[model samples]
Target: MQKGAAERKPGETDDELLHKVGTGNWRAVRLLDYPVDRILEAAGAWKAQAAGIVKPWLVWCAHPDWAVLQQKLVLSAGWTPIVGFDPRVSHVPIVPGSLRIDFNEQLQLPLMYPHFPVELAFMWIDKIAFWHSDFLLAHDMMERVATQFESLPQGECFVTHPGHPIRTRLKWLLNAKDARYWELLGCTTKEASKSQWDNGTSWWMNFQDHPNCPDKVEYERRAKCYYDHGSGIRYWHQKCGGRVRFIYETEIAHGHFTKIGNPDFKRSIPAGQSDSLRLMEQDMSRNFGLVEAAKKMRIEDLLSSD
Candidate 1:
């Protein structure tokens, strides 16, 4: 269990908030009944470390294998990547050219919630470019995107992809009760159902089931305030006077851990009792690479191969 996972009562004292920060438990601080922006403010000392870096590329990285490869690809294209990592990830890649933000020293909110980082990025830099570390883009496309974002006028923002809409739409329809799915549905204009918050990701601070959000009004406010990538882009677009645009030039290859493409990567699970033994070594090996390639291989050579 996570440290400081205790149920926080409503109207938590300032002392409690300070203690949570002092303990380096940003996850626990997230569960407190306060706005995320306020929580970020309280973490000023820790978060300020990254505030000085105002880079254009914000790469949200998780696993080392993917991050290493991504760093290679991005650097080869002549863009400086500002990579963000989950605080709890045991292995973070040490790429020389990339600026790294370890959420352990900053706010450890779920990176899946793109709004969190986008908001943070906007605090320091304008006209930012962001994508997942698992994404594979050609050198030409990277150059194109870098040039596109750099040339964006004030009050303008651009997103290269709309994401996998068909799969996401089906997932939302099948699991309408889940609020986590709602964010990705790109339906910010509609009212979200209460069940969506009730059956959402339990660890999310905004969900109805979370102990910190015991009050209906509080949870509702939290739920409504959340935004996924599509909603975030739209929100900024409207806020910036309709300057946001989605440009589809080249399709980016998302290297999903479960899927096979790279000859060095594959996901494997045991035959029976998949749920019970799903976390065994065999299953884990499938998702994670055996060695860190970013450090060993040449960037040009890695990008040259399929």
Candidate 2:
């Protein structure tokens, strides 16, 4: 039988308990079933520490549910929220206290490339962060990123999660033609053959202080280069002079490949295994609510404008 919370040894801190749980100590398994409110409260407290260390300007591109969820997470994590979206879809509701940047109006790059809006947002803020919409952030994510940034070597342009190990290796074998493609871009053998370093899902940087910061025109040019080459990761690595460091962990849960059409996708929830499925459903419900609210507000604004 596992010991309950009340049975904890005297003077054992929550951090110590969590550490034990992380290390798979049997004594800590009882802590796994914490009440949801307790977890939220703990996360809320951690938010203060995250906010104090580095309050990044978040720039996101995604649909309504993702936008709302991302906004909620960042706000709770103590960061300013900024969203970039296609005005044509226009379904992403205006999140309270968030600045929305319309990618169609502000960015000249093609919609096929998702990172352009992030790059646009990157130019607007001193300390900026960009991440994919499908990621759910851990409470201490920003604090970790900030601490890593402070400890980075001088002249590093960004810090990001390491690219997926399997995919990074497979891309070279699968896309051998990229060898010539890379050479055409004037890449050295080291640069061409280097493992993909940054995954682009979550990264932070300050353009003002970055030694290789490109101007708007140059940024766009490089973006187009990435689009042409079909690899944003490669473009960042090459153009930034490979001055990127990998975080030990991104502290984000990725559901990017969970939807249909993915090889490993599975949507059906088994009995008593509702954690991930329940969260997805809850996010969808919230997203739908926000979309309806935005539509109603948009109609009212149009009537007033007329």
Candidate 3:
């Protein structure tokens, strides 16, 4: 008789067990260290009562402050915010009833693993939205998106706005010194280098109806490629057969450096460049005020509502 599947003996490393049983053994594959099942169950409950509400799931990493602000904005806009967070960061102070899923201990993989959190969100909801932490949503953004979604033919599955050409050009110029930028763009010609891709700041999709929806394995494979090679836009464009609609003009404004709490733009600028420092200060002075005002309004509302 064939032996029963080997149980994970005491002290057996996760990698060893994974190799032994592979991913087919769901019991052996410990995906998250935290009580994600509980969180997802709570989300399911919330979703039951979420009729006519715009519920968007956001993924957070290395930016708790921004997460808090974004959560408040989501709440103020009358949308439900589901945040998937890196457990390594301090707990984000979100209002009660918001679902927060910790992902730091989920998969024993590199920090850049982007697939699992998104996949987790999709599993729970048929139609879901995603936004970057750095984006500030206009109060009417969700309403606009809902209107657009309602108007689209059943075949047109995904909706988002075009990338700001100015911002795209700026990013390319700023990263020109980095070899990673060249590798990511995969182009030697100036025209190819200058090409602008769609900004993925705020987008929603009905994956169930998406004609080109990929299976789990293919989706994860593409996600890994995105993390390793910065090819997410390319992957999405190709998968959706280059058929994406741009709706709701400028519903989201990117905070860029301020949203990430990078006061000095250290990540983008070369060190000790006085000109760059001055430019960063000017930009931050204008942009940070906007973020602060929005944050303040949310805080006041939370206090008053209580």
Candidate 4:
């Protein structure tokens, strides 16, 4: 019994995307209907925010559905897709750049949204998180790496995907460097770990049964425009059950509350009263510590064929 996708304001920053979880802004993170270029622009904008210099980081999600678009980006200008991975996805970790962006993002699409399929949403988020991260690196190779949205101190927002509580209690881990990455999918460091049940220490955004799992195509829609090229397009089956919706809703909830990585149930804050603004005082400035976001040099390695 999770809430439905919220409605977004006429024009909102990505930060508003998280409002639905706690502030109850009620806006759906609906980038699905927008044009592919729009998505690229969104990716580019976030990249500019993270990295001081605006270098084009050609990015595409690993999902096969986006394969055509990936090719187009590479062919049109300077863009490439790699250095991204989805646990549910196979054969990724595309390596065009020296830095690989990683992160988990959640969207609360309805079980019966006529136009969008949850699977597609998941693919998009997974890809965008990577895209944004690399976009930052592609831009000005800085000494410091900052997030697009205001960044919270490590353990400020704990996200976990199959996150481990035991690990949190221990707090022993270090990510690789020269590899610009974001835990977009849903992750939390030791400070952010909440004991789900002593089940595990990894704090993650746990949606009960996210429809994004890519079950079966609900129906086949003619690629109308793209079909002229004969690359058929398919959408997710909206007929999914509640389990699917529940999983997404759960993660949406966890993402907002525990974002600062204070997932401890006792740390719950009143909805709409979150410290997000204070949290994101700046878009992402190199002057800041960017604890999780460390900068890298050697921009050419990003698209390296290595």
Candidate 5:
């Protein structure tokens, strides 16, 4: 590998950056330039010295303010943060189990396929689950699903009036799925319908939105494929994954009912955590095929602290 060729790191391939980091390789440490000593060391003291390389993968899922807690866990377990992402997908700023509710309405980004130089953007699906008071946080969560949109307002809102800064901001918020809806709002120009490549031409696609459009069915299928799904539950449970149960009782016009499904809510995540911090543990375990490893690490640190 060329010394500065940006060649893949040892034990890391472009494809398996997540898995490679599951091993140990400190060079990939993201936020390497965060100025821990410069900003956090004195007042908050966030920097950790390494005796050797730290696994960029294998992290913990934690809220911020729990930095010392997470780092203490990381220090003992020999892991580090190569990537981080905060779950701003809550409705009422209050999670059932999680103490704090952070609602960023401008929450754009699907939190998926991060375009940044990140290998893994640690997410707490289970922790974020509590925010799914059905109607409570489901709509907000769907709006901010990184690159996927599930409803009308978010997709239809894509069409912009000329020189509309608000529209520009809305456009900026659009993921490919939402972008397609600009046409559903009555598109005649090429700009609105043109499909773009995500990674390559093989993955080219356009945006979408349709009234009573069974468009979301495919999205529901994808979500069910990744998460759990059930038909025996209430309507909102099936549509918004039971996160926004409030929508269950509401009557939407047309056959918007097809998208509904029982939400796959689970206590799979550990909540009651901090607000700003991100953890690697659950993510690492999820990808590494070790369910108990993350919990053990968190417990060990908690016990060791006292």
Candidate 6:
């Protein structure tokens, strides 16, 4: 084997090689077609680290004050919480039973582009469950999922979205198998459709929003490299031969719903949790945001005392 070349050792397992490439020990590997390599490569460039299983959920959070309460609930459930912090926000308070990471450090890139570090979390954790900072799991969430969480098959994923009965019915009627409504849903251009690739392409192709975005055909080719269907769950399921389970429930509460000013917007706050959310926000505002009332006291201030 050549020096500096990443050569597979005798009897080296796929999981071991996955760790190497994932941690940047091997930089980038090619020729050998492994599913792990393909998945991580699709996400982003390699970064330095050692890999090991950490938890079931990767919580991406920007505000520690807001997420601290949610973190406590996650810990009470005996579930591991890995918080992905947006580096720019450093005033996050330390919460127990949670591992905090910086997105800039992990991705080795700036946070200007809207991207999810799913590959990074998947490499360190057994399952890939990505949770937004604003969504708080119900008190009974872990207990409810204990059985299914344990029995979940390898390569399978479980996703939860804003569930509305009426919207769900309309979507089903439009997307049902052999349905004629599919014709009406077809997009004339790739940009017209929302896909996982939107994050990668938005920097260059979002002319109306970005204004400075280049209007070049070259960006389209770049977008294709990250392209996945709007039905990403289905695409990954078929590509990787895994099952994607959509948990249709109203239990997972979205914190933003409580603060939304738009009267027409639908809110999905779980039963009996609205008061808690309001109280938590009030406490944060009174204590953390009072000094810098214009903004708020940050995770840094919360941590400085500790």
Clashing pairs counted in every model: 1, 0, 0, 50, 37, 5
Model 6 segments more than 4 A misplaced: 1-54, 106-108, 112-115, 119-122, 165-172, 175-230, 237-241, 253-261, 264-306
In the range 1-306, model 2's lDDT, one tens digit per residue, is 211122466666665554433221323324444333432243233223233334454444445655666576566555566665533233766566676654344222122122332232222322345554444434455456545544443233343333444554477556633311211101111121222222221111111111132354443443333222224444455554544544322223232312424544343445444221223333334333443433432322211211
Candidate 4 yields a Cα-based lDDT of 0.25
Please provide the root mean square deviation of candidate 1 (C-alpha atoms, Å): 10.2
| lDDT tens digits by residue: candidate 1, 65-142 | 566667766676666666766443456675777887653344443322323344333344444466644345555655
lDDT over C-alpha atoms for residue 276 of model 2: 18
Better of 1 and 2 by TM-score: 1
- Distance from true position, residue 94, model 6, in Å? 2.3
Candidate 1 vs 3: which has more TM-score? 1
Q: Candidate 3: where is the Cα deviation over 4 Å?
A: 1-54, 59-62, 108-115, 119-122, 146-242, 247-251, 254-264, 267-306
Ranking by TM-score: 1, 6, 3, 2, 4, 5
Q: Candidate 2 — which pairs collide? A: none
lDDT of each: 0.43, 0.37, 0.37, 0.25, 0.22, 0.37
Off by over 4 Å in 2: 1-54, 59-61, 106-114, 120-123, 146-155, 159-240, 247-261, 264-306
Off by over 4 Å in 1: 1-32, 35-38, 42-55, 106-115, 160-229, 235-240, 253-300, 303-306
Q: Predicted candidate 6: what Cα RMSD to the true structure? A: 15.8
- Report the lDDT of model 4 for residue 87: 23
Model 6's number of clashes is 5
* Top model number, lDDT: 1
lDDT at 276, model 3 = 11
